[model samples]
Target: MESEYKHLQIGVRAAQAPKERRVLHRVWKYKLMYLLLLPACIWVFIFDYLPVYGISVAFMDYNFIKGMSGSEWAGLKYFQALFESDMFLTAFKNTLIINMYKMVSGFACPILLALALNEIRVKWFKKTLQTAVYLPRFVSWVVYGGIITLLLSPETGLINKAIEWFGGHPAYLLAEPGYFRFILVVTDAMKEMGWAAIIYIAAIAGLNPEVYEAAVVDGATRFQRILHVTLPGISGTIVVMFILRVGYIMSAGLDQIINLYNPMVLSVGDILDTYIYRVGIEQFNVSLAAAADAIKGIIGLAMVLITNQVAKRINDSGIF
Candidate 1:
């Protein structure tokens, strides 16, 4: 009986040994790919990892001349000061509200756009429309700024002129605190919707045509087909994208916000990124800014992890 047990153990060990061997061999097989990835990996290590050292300054009474070591430690004092500031509160409020709008509007806009494009029967017209929509995405927001300004300009913007032509008053869309954030959300969706649509389009395109053909044979209407077949096929993509967005909850679109924001609209438009620019660049509170950043990073990471875990539990398409 002892000999039989020993034999069974030897067989189990032999069975496990090849998995280890196979893993090592697979690693060796992809050695060149790993070599190719070295630059990007090193770049992340240097830029992303190395800069984390500066997070320490958030706890310090940092000064330029004193340098890192000589700077006095303040523990949680800066954070307490930040939490007490009205501007900080305003910044947090604006950031969350604006980003929530961006996330929902931006996320849904693309999927619907992609679905609409998929439904188009005419190839040439569809292609032209697709090109027109995507063209704005390639253009820099600097150029987009001029375009948007022309459209939203209080005096002569095409939209305002149309309003006047209809005997309505021109709304100074960007200037009003009530309208500014709404405009930001709408414009952000417009600018990036087509670009975001590209991924879903690709996902839809990769789907088996036979499934649609099968749906057609069963007399599934376009809406029904989309609801039943097309959507389920891309649910994983949707979940993954949703998870990814949840990961970046702290980032309000900095470029768009920076380009569009001005002194008149700071109350409605100031976000975490722009706040950092004000604190770090304008006021030279680099260490406090760094601390703010570290806090944002930690919160963002926590959100991602929580979101991913929840997604994994429900749908199993997770970033984990």
Candidate 2:
């Protein structure tokens, strides 16, 4: 019996050795590829992973003179204060409202634009339209904001001039709270719609040409083909992108807001990022800022997980 058991153990070890050797052989074959990836791994480690340690500042007094190691621990003191502050609540509310508006307007615009562009038979016309829309994405928000300011200027702006030509009163669009949110949503969509459509267009391009041919054979009209074939084919990509967008529900375009917003619109336009900058950088309250950031990160992470799970449940397509 002992001899039989010993022989079985030897056989198992012998079988495993070949599998181990194959894994090592494959690794050796791809050694150069792995070497190419080394720099990116190091970069992520230094820039992404290393900075995570600074999250500890949320629980500490975080004095610049004392340093991180020597800083006094406060144990959620800043977090408690943040929760009770009116500014934080206002910023949170504004962030959610603006981001939700952006999600609705900005998210659907790209997909619709891509579908429209795909139907264009004239290559030159299509290319020209794409270029015109995409050009705004490359323009810095600072320059674009200045142009928008000039265009929306009540006195000498083109839009106001046009309004006057049409016998309508010229109003200060940016200063009015009612129009501020709408401007943010529309302007953001316009700036990003073309760039966002590029991904969907690529996804559409990858669809099997035979599928559309079959749809045509089935007597599907152009719109029917788009509805039945193109949309379904790219639904997975749309879902993935939607999940990512959901994760950023807390981030309300700080650069654009900061540039376009003024004291009048701050009540409606102040978001978490801008609020964090004001409190942390301007006021020198490092701990409170860190706490706010930590909360945002945690909420964003939770949103990604929840949305991914929902996507998987619906269609079995998720980022995970």
Candidate 3:
């Protein structure tokens, strides 16, 4: 029996030898690419994975000086507080409402823009239009928000000026709670739609030209071809993008909100991220802030899993 076991072990080792060699050879062949990837790997480890250890702070009464190891365990105290706090609840509600609108509009706008751009036959005109739309994405929210603020200014904004010229009263759009969510959705689309369309455009470009030609030969109109051919061809890309977007449901564009929102609109504009910032960083409620953030992360992960499953069930497609 011992002799047979030893032989089995040896046989397994022999079987693995060539596979191991092939892996090593492939790594050596792609050494340069791996070298380039090293920095990104390190950065992700340092900034992303490393912070995971701090999640423990949420379950403890975190102290700046005492730190995680020395802090007393508080269990679910902060999480309980999150639900009990009116401010946190309000923030959570606003987050959901704003994100829902943004999600729907954001998802559809890019596809529409990509389709529009794809239909342009004139190469120079198409390129110019693409470049013009894509330019806003390169600008930081700080700058873009400032531009939007100027445009919406009650007194001097271009928009208000146009409204005044049209015999309408100029109002402070940003400060109005009713108008705040609309502004966020519109601005988000304007800033991101073009950049987001690039992926869709690429996906559309990769579709079999022959399939499109067949559709044309079948006497399909331009719209009909797009509906039957272009959309189905890019469905996989759409599913992947949708899954990714769903995963980040808790994160509602912090930079844009921070730059654009004011005290007046906090009731309608404050999100989980801003709440965490205020509670954790501003108020120095470390444990409570950590709890909120941890919950946010957990919900985001759950969302990704749920959305992926739904996508798979609907059409046999998902990120996994």
Candidate 4:
């Protein structure tokens, strides 16, 4: 039995030796590339994976002084609290509605912008127009939000002044709950559309020029060429972007909402991120906040997985 075991070990080692040598050879050959990647791997570990350990706080009655080790095990207590809380429910609903609105408008706007830009024959005019649209994305949301507030101001806004000139009542649009989500969706699209169009434009540029020429030779109109050649060429990028957008459905533009929203519009504009900030940072209810955040993460992850599968099935391509 001992002799047979020794023979088996020897055979296994003999088989593994060549594989191990090949791995070592490849590593040595790519040493420079590996070295370049080391910093990125370290950064990901530190910033992304290291925080994963703290997710346990969601299941614990986390105490600052008591620390993680001394905290009481609360199991699903916090998660239950999250579901039961009226504020959380409102935030959850608002998050979904707002993100859906943004997704529907935001997704189409960039594609349309890219297509429109692609059709422009005048280079200088296209560049100037692109710059005008892209400039909004560079502005900080704080400054942008302040600008929005000023524009919507009832007494002194340019919009109000224009309305007054037209013999209309100058209304405070920001304070109205009905208008808050619409403003968020429109502003978000305006800010992001040009920037997001860059990828689609690049994708369009990468399409085969011969295919477009063939379409033109076949008597296809400009719109028909775009439909057949351009759209199909960039469909993969579109699918990947759509999947990523769906993954963040739970996020709902925290920065934009935080800067734009007030007490009056909170009921309509409040999202999970803002709710978590209020509970965790301001109120210091750590466990409950953690649980709510955990739910967001889980939902986002699930959405990504499901969307990736659906995208693959539909388009035969995905981020994966």
Which one wins on TM-score?
A: 3
**Per-model TM against the reference:** 0.90, 0.91, 0.92, 0.91
Question: lDDT for every model?
Answer: 0.89, 0.95, 0.94, 0.94
| lDDT of model 3, residue 261 | 93
- 166-217 per-residue lDDT for model 1 (tens digits): 9999987877888889889998888889988998999999999999999999
The regions of model 1 sitting more than 4 angstroms off are: 1-21
- Rate residue 220 of model 2 by lDDT: 98
Instruction: Show the lowest summed lDDT stretch of 10 residues, model 1.
Output: 13-22
Predicted structure with the largest lDDT when compared to the true one: 2
Provide the lowest-lDDT 10-residue window in model 4.
Answer: 13-22
Displacement of residue 153 (Cα, Å) in model 2 is 0.7
Please identify which of the two predictions, 1 or 4, would achieve the higher TM-score against the true structure.
4
Query: In candidate 2, which residue pairs get closer than 3 Å at backbone N, Cα or C atoms, i.e. clash?
Result: none
Q: Over the stretch 223-312, how does candidate 2's per-residue lDDT look in tens digits?
A: 999999999999999999999999999999988999999999989999999999999999999999999999999999999999999999
lDDT for position 52 in model 1:
86
Distance from true location, Cα of 62 in model 4, Å: 0.8
What value of lDDT does candidate 4 attain over all alpha carbons? 0.94
Top-down TM-score ranking: 3, 2, 4, 1
